[model samples]
Target: MKNEVQVKGKFHYRLIGWKYSIWVRLLLFLLLALIFYMSLYVKLVPQVYDIQLGAVSEKTIYAPRQIENAVATEQAKEDAAKRVQPVYRVVNLKNDALIDAIYDKLLQINVDEEVKFDDKVSIYRRVIPQLISELENQSVKTLRNSGQYNDSLLEQIQQGLAEQQYQLPEEAFFKLPRLTKEDLTAMLPVTKDIVSKLMNDQILDAQTARAKVAELVNTSNLTKNTSRELVTEIVRAVITPNKFFDQKGTDDARGQARESVKPVYINKNDVLVNVGDVITEEIYARLDNLELLKDKANHLPQLGLAILAALLSFVVFMFVRQSTLPITYNNSQLVMLILIFLINVAGMKIISLGQNMDYPYIGYLAPMALGSILITILLDAPLAFISSVLFSLMASIIFNTEHMLLFDFRYGLVSLVICFVAVFTIQRASQRATILKAGLMISFFSMLTITAMMLMEDQFSQKEAIMSLSFAAAGGLLTVVFVIGLLPFFEVAFGILSPLKLVELSNPNHPLLRKLLTETPGTYHHSVMVGNLSEAAAESIGADGLLCRVGSYYHDIGKTKRPSYFIENQTNIENPHDRIDPNLSKSIIVAHPRDGVEMLKDFKMPKPIRDIAEQHHGTTLLHFFYHKAVKQAEEEGADNGIREEDFRYPGPKAQSKEAAIVGIADSVEAAVRSLRNPTLEQIDSMVHKIIKSRLDDGQFNECDLTLKELDTIAKTLNETLLGIFHSRIEYPSELASKKTGT
Candidate 1:
């Protein structure tokens, strides 16, 4: 027997070998990063302007980036700090001691009964002056030691104390001696209480304290005029300004006020100096601070953009590496992904160039969904989802006019909505027109997203809103155009069998499918049954059911060459293999898979369909032919050189879950169809038995199908076959029924 058929295309063969090479993948990722960097280079670098202070008659200048206006922020903070009032601390001044001393002196003078009354009155008057002087001295010392008052404050304190001192009238002094020792004691507490109360309150001056002293004395327990007057005078002399400026506390409060102020920012695209307006020193400084001034070169923006590009590339690379899809690991598929990425980024860059115009919403015109639509059609939906996110991020950056701003939420949001809409709408696309439908869906969703974004703004413009909606709708149509136009190139270049291509191949009018139906109708019917079983089983395990169905349709295209040789097409005809040697029959049986592969390649079918055709038999033995050869050798008592290996189909076993499922379905369909009246139990047993045989033969080793998925496939096939060959209920004979009725 010949070796396994090699049906790989020239381009596929060249790149397929490098799929697993780490160096090749790294280079491909580098290329992706390079595309990102180049596309964003213009937006990343700040635009430089030539202007000087006092210059006039120039075009309007908009801020190229969002930057903190340090000068303005500092000025605002200073203003906030100045708005805070000065903090003051209150001192207690020890008024209780001063009042006690004055009372003790007066009591001492009154107790001198040996002296003349007039002379004692003179002594009381003299002691009153001494006590008042002592009170003033003590207040000055206390105020100085409080650490809150300066020398100027201390002088003010002295002046306030001097003005508050009671002037002792000659009659009042004589009356002071008339008070008894008990009266003096009562008055002492009244004086101390009034002074302490007044000092505890914030006293900025002695005049304020003196005004309240008379009222405080009258309200006290002392009813005698002499005692009240003495208490009032004493209280006034002791009270001085205790509240002083707290420099440290005031500074701290101001500092907090400054800290609480938020920094002022110059928003992106904010007008710096409009046309015909002079560029003052302030305006020139602002431009310099934003790094938009000429002769100021900043490479940080470029370096940052490069880092972002590398990050996006890494995310994509990691996602592809971790994906279980067979095509994800193919170098050709990676190249296709790179090309799609470049095209999308380039479109965004081109659209961003319009930002230089007066229209800021021109970014809405970018066909952001183009890449996602193409990816969903050519690759898996999950991969397309991830690519959509990355594309939105790139669009945000590319469309951003602000050099310092990494992303614009408006662009990112709209791009994300359209990309997701495209992916979901086109995920199950079956026809070429489905791409247009996806575009329309994307367009509708884009308009909704744009409208919602515009409504969120503080200002709304009817004209701008209409323009943005128009751009969004046009963007969707453009996406459809690009997807439809570019799909054929990707399909032919990489030999990827996308869903749309599969749909076209599944058509009955295709040259190969038509030949199978016309030349080998029986085989074609068998293929259709296999397709039904394979599709159901594949769908049960989350595999590509469409690929399985379409692959099954053409899996036996080679049987068209010699339809009578196959049992399915041998309707009412003699078995041709009965006359031929079993070995020759084995060759013919095994040759069909190879012949099918060659026929598929000549027809220029995608690699996956051809792979299904080539691997569906998976080196399975020609059981009937092998056994016949064995029996013939046993009867002749001679060695016929019959090896089980030679009787087997030459196969590179199923390389994917879809191929493995198709193989299992192909076997189970033929077996169940051969049964005359397969009961539900027999059909179920047959499905499990064929699967178990394939498992034991190691046919599923190359694919990722687990034993669990195989069980699921078995269960699905059983149900499908029962539905296909359901039995009807039996009825009694008409003659017996009529006799019983008579």
Candidate 2:
């Protein structure tokens, strides 16, 4: 089951390795874009209309822009309506002519000479009633056309005649009164003048015309109330509305007034309404127009933001692709890069939630530099800088409240400055203290940026600015805290030997190094010598010298398990290999590399160190033991089990330049240490021979080292060895003789 699980794990890693390609990377970018789109879509998009009037606002709302301007646009229409004057058409001319016609008919009746006196009076009353009826019918028709006719006036006249008991063939009257020429003549002038004056003036309705007619007759020259009453009835019928309303003109005036109103604008960040204020219809409509309502599903802005996120993702992809860092091209590194970006964005989003609170500046409290520092430590500082830009942009968007589309550059600028400071300060960090120091520098820069931003603002309270500055400083420190906390997890999980970890491992007080020193001092000294040579060679080739140096320290830890068996640690002791069979000696020699790997693993050392320890020998032959075994078997005439392959170190060869360089340095250091009073020429020859032997044996086949780099390493190692094993001058003979004589 254990073996099966191990096989499964291997297969899983193989599948992951296979799937980690350009397509996977593109998909991850797409996923990142999706994350950004989802996070920012709502913040950027216009919302649905969800607010209700007379309800307490669940959250504080700021005007996206000047909304009162739009409201004033609509209010202008109402003001225009109020400004419009009522339109009227002239009907007074027609009314005046009708009055004159009635008066002329009355005069004709009064001056009649063709009838007897008593018959004239009867004839007059009858003719007068008929004439008035015909005239009233004509006047009503005219008034109707002008929309000013009043049938009620005509009805009142008939009712008044009935009240006086005056009856005629006219069925409208209930009764009629006896009439004389004197009564008719007295009323004729008074009624005509009163009707003419009332009609000539503006009379918008029948009621006003009647009131004027009644008042005129009460003060007229008539002696009897009956005569006055009869005149009022006739005049009231003549007094029709002279002014008719003009619908088209009135509408035009109103429209012009509405057009005259200038729009009122509400400024950005202006409070539209208070927390408990009732949402008026005008306010609601304005909010809707501004796309500030929570329930509105305006999608165009969301689409725009999605496009923006995709564009940013594309930029990130292109940036990574163009990066010179090898990790940028590696599948694992790509995964780590995306993971770091997402984590940073997620943290920004969490911090952004506080932006909705009373103290919106709390968003600056987020540790945006966390990812920047991590990127600087785990990857390259340049990539960290780029990531800082992206993170800052995201922070600005996520925290923006004043406007949906407008970026809050205040937060973005601060984040950028702090992140850059963190990355820059930690660029060459080689110890854990460096990260903390970088964080402090980041905090200092952040405070400066915050102060600059506050001073730039036109309106800011000193208390608020100071508080925000403090939060910004704390944000930087928090970033360091997160970076420190997360660094170990990534290192352990990825088996990455970071510079700080390498430095830590190189300490002499380390348990494995201590053990090697006490148990196998010769091997310990040899390892130290190899570390120095490898570090110098790696530096000459522009490789990771620190890693090379540290890897060399633990490369021969396996030999500590059997110190006496190894020639380096066999001080004042006889050779154990001579007493043992040649096959046993070869087995013991080859076991050291494997033993070192196990010991390193048991101590939970990083993979690079274990790899160097295991691959340094790189399947090279234990030539001395192999030849002894072969000669012994040949003498016995049984060389079947003495193949050269059986006496070789089991190795997968060097996989990195550091490992390969350490391997060469390890061999060179051991060979040079074994030499007695070695000359510079001899040391140079020995270093070249060992390198040539390794090259011929194809030990560097799996590594990426070039022949040119190998040549440099050879030259570097030869020079370093010459310095370590240079010949001593015999100059003290004269001094020694002088001291003896004394």
Candidate 3:
């Protein structure tokens, strides 16, 4: 038998093919660049202003963008340095030694017996001046050479004494009674006690030490006031400041203080100068850093942004090229992907314009989840996940607050989490209602993410937290609304056969399906069985079982156009082909697939369903009609020139796994339905036969089905068919007769 198949014209296919060529690729790249560059231009390039410090501006100059407040940062450093306390070292050891020597000399002079009272007075007066000089010299020497003596304190005390013109009377020194050993010993204890206490304490100045010495002398039980006065003078002369300033340590502490202070930031869009406000030096500097006070040309930031956008676009392109979905390779899909990303970015930008408002967290209201949900529905989850990440990155920057460094991770983090949640929960959405369900998931996740971010900020407030959570939840719902509104548009404009759309088309209430069911019930039942078989077979091979099942349900839609011409729809009626010409019968049989395709197109069904209806028969031969025509031609002894090619249906073959599996299932179901109570063995044999015939005919050549997968499909179809057409056991004859009699 000749295998005749009609070809669908290749004009659109050729056009699509040409779009993937080198020049077309470059044009697509250019288009992407233009879009990205435009999106980023205002953001990256700092808005320039030529106003100088103290200049009256023609218009109000707002801060172009955020930058470091150099002046404020420096002031913070200075304040930190000033807050560092000066360092000091203990230097009290030398003070004790100097006091001891002075005491010994006084004791020696007092104990002497060789001199008269008058001579003793002169000697005491001379010795007293010399001892005071010695004490002063020793203290000053220690202050200069060691860390123990505070020179400033010592000098301060000496200057006070010189200004007072303090002169110990000769009578006070000479009038001291000749002391016994006990007296000298008592004096020694007194001297040692006072000096030790004063030296151990942190004395930065000499006035305190002198005051302590005077208090001690006044409290002492002295025989004479003059003696007490001479002792007080000696004690005051010896006392000095022990705590000395440590310049190196103090400087190091100041350095550390400077290092500890964080650099202050000047927020983006911070008012540089209000309307009619004079420009200050600080405002000028801020504008200069933002490149608003422009004298120098700056293009690096713009170029860098361009490169970043290009890299991001390239990564998205590569991901789509290597993704698991076959539809991603279509140029329309690529265009849609880019357009979706740009639209999401545009939304972010529009919302970001108000980031400077009092409600800083208003950026949380952006519907970033829209992109993830749409991508998940239109494409696959992996692409949706990737798009979610990219959209989050864009959100972080676009929705960034001036207080944030670089990008605001709060927005990015929340967007990423919520978007991923949307993608994960709705990856297999099969109904328009599922989008609403996914929206609820997104809302819950967004609120949760917002709460987490607020808690992390360590600045969570009840009112602000509630506001943020509400906004996030609202944003999620808005995303759902946007997705629901845009989904049908994308489906129609791009001819995307989304799972939701497929589910819609698969409804029995659909016009085409209703027609098939009413006018061609036999074909309808056959299509239903085919759907079951194809679904099972598809699942076995990791194909889209839903698509296969749905495609199978509508695969024989064309049979409804000429319901009586097909055997399945003819039911118990006489065969129409008996009186009709064989060529006419062949023509009717061949016309159905095309007729179904046209009907589907007229109804504006998605392309995948139409394709399945058009390609389910593929190029398989109409063996019965061809053979009957040959036999008649031979019986009549005519030319017998009946061509086998004329008996085949017009076919583009099965172009996808779903379509191919549906085709195989359609044939198997029709073959099995013709049997009278088929046994499991007969069902298995028929299933294998149908699959082998199609495989041998190269019907699966266009799709990606492997040999192993084909075997799996055959085994799966066998099991499904056996279950549907299982043999019933006959009851025993005696049991059947007894039941009937009873």
lDDT top scorer = 1
For TM-score, candidate 1 versus 3, the one ahead is 3
Candidate 2, run of 10 with poorest lDDT: 4-13
Candidate 3: misplaced stretches above 4 Å?
A: 1-18, 30-45, 52-298, 327-329, 726-742
Per-residue lDDT tens digits for candidate 3, residues 1-742, read 1332222421123243533455656567567767777766665656677686787766766665455667899999999999899887664336566556756765676677766667667776776567656665665665667654345645644554344323565556655545445566666666667767776777767667778887887777765655567667666666665565666668888999999887665555566677776788876766666657657668788888888778877877788667655444356676777678777777777766665434578788888888888888887788888888888877777776553355778888989998998888888788888888888887888888887776777888787888788878788788888888888889888878788888887889988888888888888888889989999999998898998888888888888878898888776789889999888998898898898888888987778888888988888899999999999999999997888778887788887888889998988888877776565667778878988898898888777788899889989987786677655412255456877995
Candidate 2 lDDT, 419-446, residue by residue in tens:
8888888888899999889878877887
Q: Residues 1-742, candidate 1: write the lDDT tens digits.
A: 1432222221122232576556887899999999988887766766677887788937888776565668899999999999999886666666777777877877887788887888877787787778778866877897688776767656655665566566656677777778788998788777777877887788776687789989988888898887888777667667777776666678889999999988776656667878999888888888888777776677788888889889989999889878876455567688888999988888877776666434677888898999998889888899999999999888887787654476788899999988998899999999998998888888899999988887888477788888889989898898888888899999998877888988888999999888998889999999999999999999999998999999999888888878889999998999899999999988888788889999998988888999999999998888999999999999999976778998898997887888889899989989988887566667878999999999999898777798899999999998888777766211235445766995
Which predicted model would earn the best TM-score?
Answer: 3
lDDT of 2: 0.75
TM-score of each: 0.63, 0.63, 0.65
TM-score of candidate 2 on Cα atoms, chains taken together:
0.63
Off by over 4 Å in 2: 1-22, 50-296, 324-329, 356-358, 454-460, 633-642, 722-742
lDDT of each: 0.82, 0.75, 0.75
lDDT computed for candidate 1: 0.82
Residue 520 of model 1 has an lDDT of 93
Model 1 per-residue lDDT at 25 = 76
